[model samples]
Target chain A: MLERALNGGKLYWTWIGFLLAVFGVGFLFYLQQWNVGLGITGMSRDVSWGFYISQFTFLVGIAASGVMVVLPFYLHDYKAFGRITILGEFLAIPAVIMCVTFIVVDLGQPYRAMNVIFHPSPSSILFYDTIVLNGYLLLNLLVGWTCLHAEKKSIAPPKWVKPFIILSIIWAPSIHTVTAFIYAGIPGKHFWLTAVMAARFLASAFASGPALLLILALIVRKFSKFDPGSEAIQTLGKIVTYCMILNVFLLGLELFTAFYSGIPGHMHAWEYLYAGIDGKGVLVPLMWLSAILAAVSISMLVFPQVRKNETLLAIACVCVFFSLWIDKGFGLVVGGFVPNSFEQVTEYWPTLAEFSIAMGVWALGFLILTVLYKVAVSIKEESGGEAIH
Target chain B: MKIERREFLKLAGLSAIFGLGGTAIAASVQQTPSYIPDPKELTGKRWALVINMDKFKTDADVKRVIEVCHTKHNVPNIPNPKQEVKWIFTEMMENVFPEQQDKYLTEHYKHMPFLTLCNHCANPPCVRVCPTQATFKRKSDGIVMMDMHRCIGCRFCMAGCPYGARSLNWIDPRPYLDPKKINPEFPTRMKGVVEKCTLCYELIAVGKIPACAEASNGAIVFGDLEDPKSEVRKVLAETYTIRRKPELGTRPSVYYVIGGMKDAGKGA
Candidate 1:
């Protein structure tokens, strides 16, 4: 089954080559960062976390979103999702890898990262996050691989795998929730101090995760014989629609609480993100662009006519993916740091080396995703163009 | 390849015992001896600092205190404000105590420079959020202590602290330190560790006080809050003092005596 990924068309090999080139460039910059320290990045004492952490947050959501397909098929017995559930699980494997990589690159002492495990602090949310994320990754790998391997043999998946599938279903939300707790539990960070943080994270994750899955499914359908079924794609589109709506609504609630209450601590971060604070608002234009994209994508997704059109749906997914990327990945993390502990604004923008390192991590993830998806799709195509359940 | 039930049971039992015994040996090997306090150490139930803002009469007075602490600690002198790392520094009264600031506040109160350092909170969020026990509060005297070697430099503590006390060594700090001025007694931090004021724990171990407190010319007082007769307690008893962001429930050990001066002058 693994050998299937090794044998690919020229286009596939070219794509792989492109990703490798990008990864190589990024690795060089990462080496520079390793030598110089985090001072190579734009992060400061005022804004301690920057691009790397934000990417980690976003990718965690992507990993958790695998539950969307897994839950419907395994728990609710939604037959349509059975075709694409493996896709979701395989996507999660690479997403989790990327999340861990982003965190490692962001660390000032990447070698000492195992200290979290060696000297475990249950009091810290980061400790719990480490446990859940690695657990979720293992769960997805086991469930997806076992089921897919069983399918290749044209037999029912092992009965023992069912309990693991159920566990993965429950474990998915815990990963994102623990990640949210990392920020929400911090005392002085008013922007992330809201109780709704976990809920908001889940909403955005569900939206962005399914949106990316929808886009990937479309791409897979175009390039491969595996259809993934139109019904499955439409169902995912619906999931993205509802989740994006909830995500926007939760964001609106946050805005209302910040503005209506008129709390300086709460409102200051919002002001810094959307409007210039003391004439230093680098993220203002990007934030507004995210807002416009969200509104446009949500409106387009709600209409059945637009969603039924594959071209229109792909555009909507792209919008949702990038919009949420900006909102959660860029805005949320940096906003919390902006109106810093002293109510002073200090802007953060990733340096070129930082961007290169991040891009390399993304390329590594995609490289993994391509190989996994190739194996999964080839197995499906071999089994008479329909996914074996 | 099949083994008899009796033989399988024996093998399993033997491996289990060896595994348990190996783990016990490893744990014993890893165990570190407990610390013994020096007899000459200045003992306290809860060490605290009270800054007499009135005593800081000149800009040079505040600079001298900051210089003494930074020099003693080997804190890097990074000129870039964005990447600057400081154990103790100064901020205006208005910025330091934003909750206390107002339009009607006098210029003397508004412009006064207040020394800022780690509060070493009684219920510190930094200690709570640390994934490893890199930063912890000393149980003996309630001083917040940082193990730079243990710190992974995740900067979670920086976000957890409300007073902006912690600083990450963003670059190699050895180059930033002057060779002649480098303190041999105190360890200079590496590029990838979070550090902050240790409240002069080293000095306290030798029956002295914090470097800043010693250099402040009576502006800073250090003592045990648990002791009723301590100078810090007497200062708190007499003067109207405030802690930064007390509403956050961190219960900072550091206090600032506000409006205690008979003759207030322009701040530097």
Candidate 2:
């Protein structure tokens, strides 16, 4: 199973090379940041978090999305997902890694990150986030590897792995919830002070996670003789459609509450995000674009004919995934900081260096995803294209 | 192995016991002290600061208070307004007390500047949200405290603070600091940590009043709010003073004495 990743086509090798090169450039920027401090980033005292934290928030959702596959396959006994559950779980491993990396890079003292464990404050949501994230990472790695190894050996997975898989199912949603709590629990940050934050996070994650998975599964099916099966892909598309609809509906609910109440605290953040506050609409275009893409994607997903066509399905998945990415990755975190505590408009935009470092982290995630997917695919291909079940 | 349910349960139970035992041992081995002094001991004192705006005569007098605080605290004098480190500074009355601003107020009252700093809230969200005990409210004095050495600089504390009180050292502050002008006894801060007004804890510890209060020429009053006979208590009892964002329920220890003015903006 390990040796399988060693073999790849010229295109595969080239993709890996491109990712590594991006990683190298990003690493250099990280080194510069480490040397001069976070001053190199566009973050200020007003907007203490910018690109890094937003990415962290988005990736946590991606990490939690693995549960969509695991829950259906294990709980409902959905047979279609058997071939790709390992892929979803493996995807979580790197996604969680990216979440942790983003947090470390955002920290002013990255070296002191161990202090979360060294001196834990249980009251802090970040403390819970650390515990659940690391625990989820381990759970996925153990369950994924055990199942894959068992498949390669042409035997049923050990009975012990069953309990852990169930645990993973329950633990997956907790990661995103805990991450949401990090924002939602803050008092003065009106943008994140909603009770529905965790629900919204989970809904978007369920949609975006499987949508990304569908894209990758399509790529795998196209290039390799092994097919993850149309049934699994279509089932995942249904999950994405339902979750994304819920996500957009929740966004509308947030808008209604903010505007209906007309509370300055609640409405100011929305104003700054959508229409701009004090004549500064830096994120207005991005937010509108996300909303439009979300609407179009949902419409495509809802129609049976559009969803049935694999190409249309792929495009819909891309739209949902990218739309949610903009909503979470750019709008949520930065919008929460603008009209800061003083009700002053201090806009934040990522510098080239900052964006490059982000790219580096993404490339790193892809590099890990490539290796892990290759291994999983090879094991499945060797085991006659399906798990023993 | 095809284990039965009973056998699997037994194995899980054994692992659980060992796991619990391992955690207990590890916890005992790393028995670190609590980050702040016990709240039980804090009942002896609850520090408060009250500023009487009526006593304030000139803008230079306010500047003197700010200057003394910065000099005493050895706060870096970064020339850039965007990156300056402020422990205590003056803010326009309209900006600082937005809710209290009045349209009918005289020009003198309209443009007047008031001193501002951390409220040092009785119930501080910053202390509550800090991952490490880097930001803690002192139980004894009720003053919000920061231990920069322990701060991981995640800025959660900054987010948690409602008043925009905290500032992160975005760059190494030493390069911008004037060594000759800085207090020799007060230590400068390193980059990559959140810092703010500590209410001159060092001065308080030495039985001297805060630098800002000492320089305010009896305008800024400092005493124990819990003490019924203290000057701060007396000022609050006799004067019509207000705290910033009191509706938020942070119970800020700082109070302002506004002279016979009404919030005309609020249909006065």
Candidate 3:
């Protein structure tokens, strides 16, 4: 399978080279971050977690999205997903990898990462997050690889794989839920003090994950002999549409609870994010853009005609992906720290070093994704279409 | 390949149970005590602080306390307000207790700065959320303490703390120090760890009071809350006082006596 990854078209090699170049630049910036410590970033005593932790939070949702396909296929026997379950699992691998990298890059002392493992605090949500994330990563690797290996051999997957696949179905939700707990469980952080956090996280994840997968499937169709099949793409679009709707509804509930309750603590972060608090409105425009895009994307996706049209569907998926990214990746983590415990608004915007390091991590994820997708697609082509029954 | 189908299923089932069960057992074994202590067990020392608002006659009084604490503890005097590391400092009443702010009395309370520091809460959120147990409350004295060497510098404790007491050394603080004026008695902290006021735990161990309390001219009272006869206990008994964010239920040890404006001519 790895050998298949070594063989790719000129476009594939060029893409890899481009990502590597970006990664190289980002790695240099990381070295500087290491030397200077976290001072190089925009984070302060007030806004401690900046871009890195947010990205990690967002990517955990993406990784957990694999369950959307897993549940529909394995539990409900949705045959259309059989063509693309490998894609979801492969996407998760890189997403989880990127999640771990973001945490590493964000650390003030990367060398002390092992301390979490050696001294596990069960009371801390972070300990559970680390456990579920690592477990999910291993489960994906085992299940995806073993099943793909069986497909290559033209045989039923080993009897052992079924159990792990079932376990993975249950495990996926735990990763994002625990990640949400990292924020929601905090005492004084009012922005994240909601019961629906895990549910909202899962909704956005289910939407964004499949949305990204649909876009990737279109790319696969354009560039290769393999067709991920119209049925597969259409089914995924439907999944994205429903999840995006749920995500929007959940967000509305959060807004209503904050505004209607009129609790200053609950409304403070929303006011800061949506409208500037005390005249500092760095994220206001972006949040509005996210809301507008969400509405447009959901409207576009709901119509069967637009979803049937490949180009329109692709456009809708892209909008959904970016909308959720802005919501979860940008505002969610940073906004929680606003009105720091003393009720002072200390804004955070990423510095060049921080952005570059983040870009480098993103590039690394894409590179891993590209290699895995290449191998999976090559296997499908070799097997004369979709890998297995 | 020759193994029976039933045997394979049995083997798979057993392995799955053990595989998952083993991790659960290991995590349980490695677990530390919950950050929340048994209230009944907290029988010995219950250190508390009482800041008399009436005695703060001038800004220099608060400034002097901050200077001594920062100078002794090697807290970096980062010029940037955003990146500053403050262990103990004064904050205005409106900012410190927003809920207690009165629009009609705003002008009168303009200069009222509450001496704020780590609450050393009975149930400290920072200690609960620390994955490495780097920040833990001392069982002996109920002082919330941080182990810099063990800290992973995750800043989870910073988020967990409601008092805004914990500060992360974002960079190596050594460069910011005046080497000629560096305090040799206490160690300077390195970058990438959370730290806060230990209620001057080291000085307390040596039968000495905290520098800020000593320098406060009887304004800051430090004594065991459990000992009813102690100065802090007596101050609380005699005066109407308030704690920061008591609604959050952190049970802060620090108390503030907001004496009436009519008593402005007299000091505590």
**Highest lDDT scorer:** 1
Candidate 2: clashing pairs of residues: B42-B140
Q: Write the per-residue lDDT of candidate 3 for residues A159-267, one digit (tens) a residue.
A: 8888999999999999999999999988889899899999999999999999999999899888888788999899999999999999999999999999999989899
Query: What TM-score would you report for chain A in candidate 3?
Result: 0.99
State residue B198's C-alpha deviation in candidate 3, in Å: 1.1
For every prediction, compared with the true complex, DockQ reads: 0.70, 0.50, 0.61
Cα displacement (Å) at residue B255, model 2: 1.2
- Interface DockQ of candidate 3: 0.61
Grade the docking of candidate 1: medium
Q: What's the candidate order when arranged by decreasing TM-score?
A: 1, 3, 2
Error of 3 at A286 (Å): 0.8
TM-score of 3: 0.92
Candidate lDDT (C-alpha), each: 0.91, 0.87, 0.88
Candidate 1: clashing pairs of residues: none
Pull out the clashing pairs in model 3. Answer: none
Question: Which of the two candidates, 1 or 2, achieves a greater TM-score against the reference?
Answer: 1
lDDT of 3 by residue, B1-268 (tens): 3357457555656655778564554455357456664433323387888988667668898899999998888887898887789988878878888777667764556547877899999888898999999998888778998889889899999998988898888888888887777899888888888889988877786667778898898889888888988988888888888998887777898998866334664532
TM-score of chain A of each: 0.99, 0.99, 0.99
Indicate the worst ten consecutive residues by lDDT in candidate 2 chain A: A380-389
